[model samples]
Target: MQPDDLVLLTGRDHQRVTVAAQEVGLLPGTRARVEGRVLDVTDTDAVVGLADDLSTRYGGADVVISNAVARLLPEESQAERADEFIDVSNTATHTILRAFGPVLRPGGRLLVVASSLGTLGHLDPRLHHLFDGASLDQVEYAVESWRGAIHHRTAQEAGWPVWLNVPSKVAQVAAVRAVAAERRAHDLAASTLIASVCPGMVDTATSRPWFSDYSQAQTPAQAAEAVLDLVFTEHVDPALYGELVRFGKALDWHDGTPPGEQDTMVTP
Candidate 1:
């Protein structure tokens, strides 16, 4: 990647991102050459428009980061608003990939912000069937199925948060893996690397209001740095291309262990 490559940051709030960009030394005049755009990933038209605009203006993106996320509020999960959870977690990610995947150039990188909860072994038993032996099509079905279940529930049961939080992440990572396989089989000439990463309890304004404690959480800058390390580093291991990374390390999802357990595992 060029030192002055354009880094497009999109979100619902471009102003806040502008401030963030400045703090990260990614302003208009800076060496990072960053620009911010207001985008609602949930809106299909908006997402398509952004991709078209990017393709027209710059040919394609060298790096695409699908980091737009929505967290469940403590009270909201108690109600029948599971649709919101599904939209934020699963649907939004699906939309982003569909719209932007074509616009990613050869030798580019695609990184989605997944979570530790996404690991199949780490998921709650109640939702294990959703992921067990699931193909990408099955994962998508699971997300829609959960949304429908929440809508039809007769009681004010509070299972939305756990279901939405982890399952959505599971789907995200699974999508990354599936896409990597497809890319390898069909677009081998591109040599693009696509994967997801868990930022590990980032202590941001978006998270602080929901998480009970900020202790041990990484700052936004710190988390971004870890991702950038993976993004910019040359000669990445082929095993990491389709895996879920954390703290600049890749985890083996099939190891039958939670992500935390695999964190200290030497790759010998």
Candidate 2:
């Protein structure tokens, strides 16, 4: 980012994010101008308020990265709350893009932080019918169906994180594709690029509980590097504009088996 480029960071907790920004060299007038606000991505009103503040403060964002996620551990009482998972992983993701997509400048980039586990292959072929339509309604239906399928089971019985998270992310990836298609068809003048990414298992609050083996996990900075590569790199392929990427490689939905192997990465 340039010295003049402004950074607007929003989250539910502002103080921690502020300190973290400062730690990362994002200062008021040194490296870049930084602004932090407490905002919830799931609250439509809060999200719109933040967007309005952005317009009043600095017009709009050039890039929007949707990385909000929620994880339910196996031991948690309501770990089987698939509805909440859908809200965070699918609805909030589309909400972020929908709220900010129009204001994004021409050639701007919109990235949705999705999971590698989010693929049609992971779902039973019979369940694929949910994602066949182009409308957002279908997206919601797909999420609801997946959630309902596992709603009655406990986290341990339902495979904890994967069952709920994978399908929610699948809905999100489908949403991202729809968002990209909408941008291409309607916002022809702006020509924005929207893509999804799986930031390989990182040792963080949401991931650590489910993925206990963090010995080889990427640090927060290392994961950010993957996101930065997509944002600043000049050699990005146009084909990746509406696809899912991980470790700098684009992933194609496979047919043989669902992920979770030594050579394959399933979670984000």
Model number with the top lDDT:
2
Across 1-268, the per-residue lDDT of candidate 2 in tens digits comes to: 6778877666778787777666656434457766676777779888777766666777777888888866576565443465676777787876777778767766677899888876667755555566644556677666665566566553334332345665677678778777777666444444556789988888787777666578889888899998888887654476677778887777774422443423223367
**Candidate 2 displacement at residue 151 in angstroms:** 5.4
| Model 1 lDDT, residue 222, Cα | 82
Error of 1 at 32 (Å): 4.1
* Model 1, global lDDT: 0.68
TM-score of each: 0.80, 0.82
Question: Which regions in candidate 2 have their CA more than 4 angstroms from the true location?
Answer: 25-30, 77-79, 145-162, 185-191, 254-266
lDDT of 1 at 168: 66
- In terms of lDDT, model 2 sits at 0.69
Question: Against the true structure, whose TM-score is highest?
Answer: 2
TM-score (C-alpha) between model 2 and the true structure: 0.82
lDDT of 1 by residue, 219-259 (tens): 88787897887777655557677788888778766434332
Question: Any residue pairs clashing in model 2, and if so which?
Answer: none
